[model samples]
Target: MTDNLNEFNKGELIIENKRDKRLDNALLTTYEGDTLLSCVYIEHNSLPELSIDDVDTTTTFFGKQVPFPLMINAMTGGTEQGVEINEALYNISKELGIPMEVGAQDVLMEDMDTAELFLGEIVEEVNRPTVLLSNLHANSSVADIKVAMDTINADGIALHLNPGQEIFTKDGISNFVGRYESIEKAAKEYGDKLIVKEVGFGMSEEVIKKLVDVGVKNIDVSGSGGTNFVEIENLRNFDYDFSELYEWGVPTAKSIINARNISKDITIIASGGIKTSLDIARALILGADMVGISGEVLKYLIHGGYDYAKDYLQELMYKTKIVMLLLGCKNIEQLKKTPYKLTGKLKEII
Candidate 1:
């Protein structure tokens, strides 16, 4: 609300509607593909001397231990609905002691005032989430990263790769030539603090290997089985037909394996279509250091409001612990090493 409603900046108007459109599309769309997490089944332990009370979900994010490995992930910011979503996700992250990576900070560079509105009263240090990550695009400059982090007081910055969305969206970047070089430079300056992420289409072995070779440590595959930006952009305009690309991208489970195969030092964040406790456990078992849920969480928040969102995540945590107990794992480390077998299409791919 920095500008007058009557005379809104035309550029901001487009972004505002785009943000609203994403949420609107998300509210109506249900993913039709599989994340292939079902292929990863944690072998149940009949006797481990571990009770339900002994199960622990704690894991490290940005070098800080949290109650669980699940993160809310980047969704939106800079608009009215964007503000609400950030605040709700922020509160949930704070209460649950998890990370919350906000959507791209492109707006913060233009208008710093929106940063205050984006995160709400939590702009103050003591009130923010335990781990807050600012987001930017893959082709962003180091200066952009610094400015975005400064504007939002973020602990780190995530440089996201979304070539598919960029190619299809109106006025989106078509030439993605220097993204890797830019990311390499950012990784050098930020070290492990920089996260190179894929925007839902998932990451391939080649891309994962390239990122690892460039000194990037933190990675969010953001694999398929969740939200589809191409579909969202296509839905935004019914005149065009993008139905053929709906089933594109790598599944979340397979994406994690791709990263894991690249290097053990690489920190993997499994996301995209993470809905159930089984999904959470499967992600961990598949080599994800942490799990992220965005589309599903947004769906809950939109339909049930803040209270419902909180309750839904709480129940998810409970169910995740139950999965750990069944697997005879007492903590995250145990769960990571838990036995799993691959079946179906996923089994053939990896």
Candidate 2:
């Protein structure tokens, strides 16, 4: 594997591939479908009184105190358009005092110079003590990830496991052999800085245990009910119809519970199809320490622009606080203990 920029040009193509596919999906498909988060309702407190001004939304993760638990999930970066999108997202993250993860930096491992010149420059411009997270493919080794981390001074690295997405997408990495081995090696080297995540499909309790065994302490259960990569890839490949697998993978709420059942010590990052403040509140109630929003944030940036995105995020944080006050919960820890009933399909799944 030559580390030439030309060789890595193919990897850059994949970034474009994902970006185009997602845009098309957002335009053509329906995002109105429920994330199933509506099933978990927070118990409303009528008699209880809590000052809305006193509601604290801040939470700690990766040894940093983030103003909010919301994370701008990895979106784009490789080309000129990607840099523009990253710029908007970076600015929004900085303004909101929340964490943001860059899209997979596998491009950097292949072509360091180009990635650094583009994405790295955006990170440098957004430079701060914020909890910026880096990302890469699950099969990436420790050395490959080190380059990604160094590119942005990442507080943590997310290795996204997307066998389902790859299996369908044209030119996708079909061979995920030795991926777990790579994860083990990276975990050994990075310790708690390593985050094993799913693309859209959620992880099972069994898989969570395996990752825990490999010394993984942070897990982002990027479950289904959000962006269906299989459906997106099928949309990319016009000839094939993979719609049968559209509702595949565990829902985000269920996935969080599954991971919680497996380990209480590990940090659980709930993501995938997170659309509203209620969704964020529900995830926290179900044991998620942090929540990641990709499609929602990117959609705002693409459709409404930077200022719109910032205002939307600010409103979301406000709603999250309102939910807390309504539940008589002052902080994230208290919110976790807030009583709630799980009903409908979610109950069956749980």
Best by TM-score: 1
Instruction: Residues 1-350, candidate 2: write the lDDT tens digits.
Output: 11222322233433444544555465455533455788996778996577998888888988889988998888766655566666667767877889888887777766766565335455554447578888899988788888888888788899999998888787777887898999999999999898999988899999999999999999999998987788778777766787877878888988899999999999999998998989999999999999999888766666555667788889999999998998898888899998888999998878
Candidate 2's displacement at residue 349, Å, is 1.9
Candidate 1 residue-wise lDDT at 85? 70
Q: Which of the numbered candidates is closest to the native, going by highest lDDT?
A: 1
lDDT by candidate, in order shown: 0.83, 0.81
Q: What TM-score would every model get versus the actual structure? A: 0.92, 0.91
